[model samples]
Target: MPHRTYLTTPIYYASGAPHIGHAYTTILADALARFARQSGDDVLFLTGTDEHGPKIEEEAARRGVEPIELCDEMAARFRSAWERLDIGFDRFIRTTEDEHKAVVRAFVQRLHDRGHLYAGSYEGWYCVHEERYWTEKDLGPDNTCPDCGRPVRRIEEENWFFRMSTFQDALVAHIRDHPDWIVPEVRRNEVLGFLEKPLGDLSISRPRSRVQWGIPLPFDDDHVIYVWVDALVNYLTASGAVDPSLGPEAPGFEDPTGSWWPADLHIMGKDILTTHAVYWPTLLMGAGVPLPRHLLAHGWWVVGETKMSKSLGNVIDPLQLQEQYGTDAVRWYLLREMPTGSDASYTPERFLVRYEELANVLGNLAQRALSMIVRYRDGVVPEGDAGGLDDAVSTTLDAVAAALGDYRLHAALAAAMDLAREANGYVEAREPWAQAKDPARAGDLDDTLATLARVLGVLAALFHPVCPERSAELARRLGLSGVQTLQEARTDAPGGRTVERGDPLFPRVDV
Candidate 1:
């Protein structure tokens, strides 16, 4: 059976337009999913909008539109942005979907039946901006919500609370026993430290009289489920945990048990670690659902020393970037430049620098090498004597494979580029232009052209996942057929076919 891998980004809250931060997370998830597919894994990638919340309702009211109408409009924007970026998600689940609602209700009801949920009066400082109730200590120095930087209002409302405090010790123990489940040691330490403090019962439901834009509670008619509770269920909802067989729509969808019980990874932002690492697992345990295998929390994106925010007027529109520089260029710069699990600044200058380095340096190498082959060898791939080439090319290929296998994508790309650099150096050293003048040394020209074609073939294959369109064009120009797996491309073929020249991989950008 093929190995199964499930990856997800937090369902983005649809309170505003999709920003660069949202695009960053989904892009990272997309890259991982692409890598897994290249590695021959059966993968399911999930991303969507978190449409039901007080924030959505408030925004709707301000616009004199119904909450659902607001959600519908904003959700479409999110979908369009993702499609433009080529996210390649298996399913874009909206929280308002019937399947999702049913799953959330069933899970919450199970928790209630198991005595993990109870009626309570929640009196706390609520942040309409955050759609969460914050405790006194959670406030900032000026008594404002830390996330939104706005004064929170103290409100007392009847609601159902999940007994999150009941499983604090268990969660701590789980983290202790499975340290590898969380990527980056610092993130794991942070989760452990948070759990070391007093745990609170999470407010899981809000009174419908106050907020009607959420999933209605199964046990009560006048209350709706909290947004976080409804939102977190998307993980299981997309995984076929509810209504087994994935609601009768998925092919070969079986009851998610045994091998499919727990998710392989939950890719989310560091801001939501508390929810994913702590509340999500505890809630699952309460409902007798399987805990996820891993939760990899990544840091936020900062722009010019400030976090990207709509209110701050520093939000980078992903569509603009895609429009200016093609989707693959945007995708390549993000994964190639940013070290996973760390924050990176987004700037036009930085993007331009990386694009030129990659497109001109790495991309130009393939173009030049293939052009030479077509010019000299009549568009036929020349054969290479494996014993004649330098050992450096083989060494670089090995290093690239090792980095890719270890999930060090930046390092992998670097290694692949190093091969391109090596090929360029070989061309310079061989002086193919000088050798072509003498008909007596025609064999030498054949050898030089053949070596260049072989190396370009390998580079094209390795680059396919990063800059897919450019790589395919490069592969075609090199007279290669079909998608060449990394393994096959790395090997030197003695009877290789001809090379064909094509358009430049990356067209020059104005800005």
Candidate 2:
């Protein structure tokens, strides 16, 4: 059986429209999933919207419609944007689904029965935007939400409380023993710092009078589940582990069971470190489920040193950008410009710069090499000695695979780009243009075209995860249909096969 890799993107909030930040996270998850699949792993990728919350309810009331109506419209927008980007997620989970509600109730009831939950009355600083309670000490100097820096309201209510404090020490030790559990050395340390403070019991529900737009606690229908708790269970709920009905049918075998439990990776923005790193693990331990193997916290995108927001009138729409440039071009920009676990600046100028390299470097190489094959070798991929190109291509592939192994996306892209640059240099050195001058030098020309084809093959396979459509086109152009693996890349071009060239994969764009 292939190694199983289950991963998830932090579900986008349904209260807002999809933006470039959401697009970036989804694309990153998609690329990682694609890489795992091409590396011969059984991969399950999940992404979706968090549709229940007081915010969604308020927004609906203002619009004179049901909260579900608002959620449906916003969820459709996200689905459309992801489809436009060609995100091949295995499952797109929405919290409003009936199966999801069942899973939430069942999971929470288990926690209640396990003595991890109890009834309580509490007064605290609550951030509506974050759906979290902040202690007086947890608040910023301006008395705002520490996470989002938004104002908080003081609220007193009777609700169910989770015994998150009980497992604090265990979580800290687990993280220390397995430092890689939380990625990006910086984020790991931040979580440790947060743990230095005593852990507090979590308020785990909202009275119906206070907020009613969530799953009802299984034991008590008068209170709705806390938004964070409801949202966190989704990771397990969407898998076939906790609630079979909630999970979609896994493509291959029947009854997936817990094969995908203890997820391989949970990809989220750095802002949610406490939720995934602390609350999630403690909740899992309380319910007797193993912790996810890894938590990767990535950075945010800012527009010219300012965070993009609607009130600020500066949000970047992902669909508009994709429409302006091809989907792969936009995907390339996201992968190329940002290092994993680092903030990336989003600007039209920076986008065009990265976009140029795709059209000029990779695009130019493919067009020149294949056009030569057709002109000099009758469009047949010849198996002339790959020459030094084999070592060059192989080395780059190793570098790319290594970088991907560590989740260094920008580095992986750089490794692939280096191979493209070297191939271009090899073309210049061989002067394939001048080599074709002699009709008698046909064998020598075949050897040159052969090496170029092999190099292009490796590039297409290596880049397949990042830019699927263009990479697939290039793979077919090299006479290797669906050639998406490293092993397949090596054995491509069995010496004398015809291939076709399409219009330019990325037409050069004017900045």
Candidate 3:
């Protein structure tokens, strides 16, 4: 049976504009999803908008529009951006959707009935910008929000709280027991360190008068489900797995039919690690549903020398990038630039550096080989033995598989680029163009072209996850319609099919 894989990006907050941070997280999740699918997994990729809470209500009121209207507009922007980026997401959930609200209600009610929830009055520093309450120790000396460095207003209210403290020990043990539960040793350590500290009970609901644009609680109409609770439940609702009426075996959440319980991974920006790594798992555990297999938190995308934020007037609109460079170019740059769980700078220079890799390296290699094939062999793919090219292809495939196994996306991409470099070296050394000029060297020329085609075929398959459109085109030109997985890439065996030369895979961008 194919391995079952389910992954998600945190449903983005719809309060502010869609920035590059949102794009980066969503794109990364898309790439990982595509990789799993190409690797022969049954994958579900989920992303969506978090359209509940004070921020949305405030923003909508400010804009003189209904909350749903505001959500609709912003959600469309997000969808358009993802579409332009060629993100092949399986589901795009919205927190305001009835399906999602129903699931959130059901899940929260289960937790409440099971004694995991309680009504309480609270008073503390509340970051209205973040819609989260913080204790005195968490606030900066300036009394600014620790999260975004903005001023926070003090607020007092009665709210429903989740028993987050009860799961501290269990969560720590789980993290220790399953080291892969949170990706990259650094992030895992961060979560464990957090667990070492005392965990306060989580506020799980907001009074409706305070935040009128959210899902109302099943038992308490006067209060709505917390935005975190409503948003996090999306991963479950988006799966299309729940019957809404059927309750699973309390502890196991068993889906013998494999209908999407127990997510394989959730990919999000590092800022929300605690929410995902801590609250999400405990929430599931409290409700007797199995925890997700992994939570992968990736770093931020900052502009030159500083983090990109709307307030800073330095946010890079992803659409502008897509308009300047094509979709595949932007997608390739994003995936190839960032090391797993590490911050990456998105400056013009850095963008060009990645563009060069596409235009000067992979694209250049593809154009040269195909053009030469057409000129010499009349576009018929030449035949050769499992020469050095096979070893190179095998080595490259192994490297990509190994790198991706540890969630090293940058390393996986680097391995593919290395394969391109090896192919370029082989072509330069052999001088297949010179060999084509001599009648006696005809056999050598054919073998050399054949070797190039084989290597290129493997690359096309290998890069299918990162650059699907270009890779699929290359595969077709190389006569590899059926080759999809890395395993298939190794044995593509190009020989008899007719090849065609096309325009450049990636054109040079005018800087």
Q: Which ten residues in a row have the lowest lDDT in candidate 2?
A: 246-255
lDDT of each: 0.80, 0.85, 0.84
Instruction: Report the candidate with higher TM-score, 1 versus 2.
Output: 2
Candidate 3 residue lDDT tens string, 70-187: 9999999888878888899988898888777777887888898789999999888888788898899999868999988888888788899999999889988999999898998899
Question: What TM-score goes with each of the models?
Answer: 0.92, 0.94, 0.96
Which candidate number maximizes lDDT?
Answer: 2
Please list the residue runs of candidate 3 whose C-alpha ends up more than 4 Å from where it truly belongs after superposition. 246-257, 480-483
Q: Tell me the number of clashing residue pairs for each predicted model.
A: 3, 0, 0
lDDT of candidate 1 over 121-184, digit per residue (tens): 9888999887888989899877799888988888999989999999998888888999777876
Considering every candidate listed, which one attains the maximal TM-score? 3
- Weakest lDDT window of 10 consecutive positions for candidate 3: 247-256
Model 1, stretches more than 4 Å misplaced? Answer: 141-143, 244-255, 258-261, 386-407, 438-441, 492-496
Give one digit per residue, the lDDT tens place, for model 2 in 1-511: 8888999999888988878888988999999999899888999999999988799998999999999999999988888889999899999999998877887787777788788999989888988987888889999877898867888999998989999999999999999999788988899999999999999998889999989899988799899998888898888877767543432222211233555876899999898878999989998888777788999999988899998777789888878888899889889999889889999889999999888888889998999988988887789977787654888877887888788777888999998988899999999998887889987776777789888887788888888888898998898887776765788767666478676767787897766
Models, CA RMSD each: 3.1, 3.2, 1.9
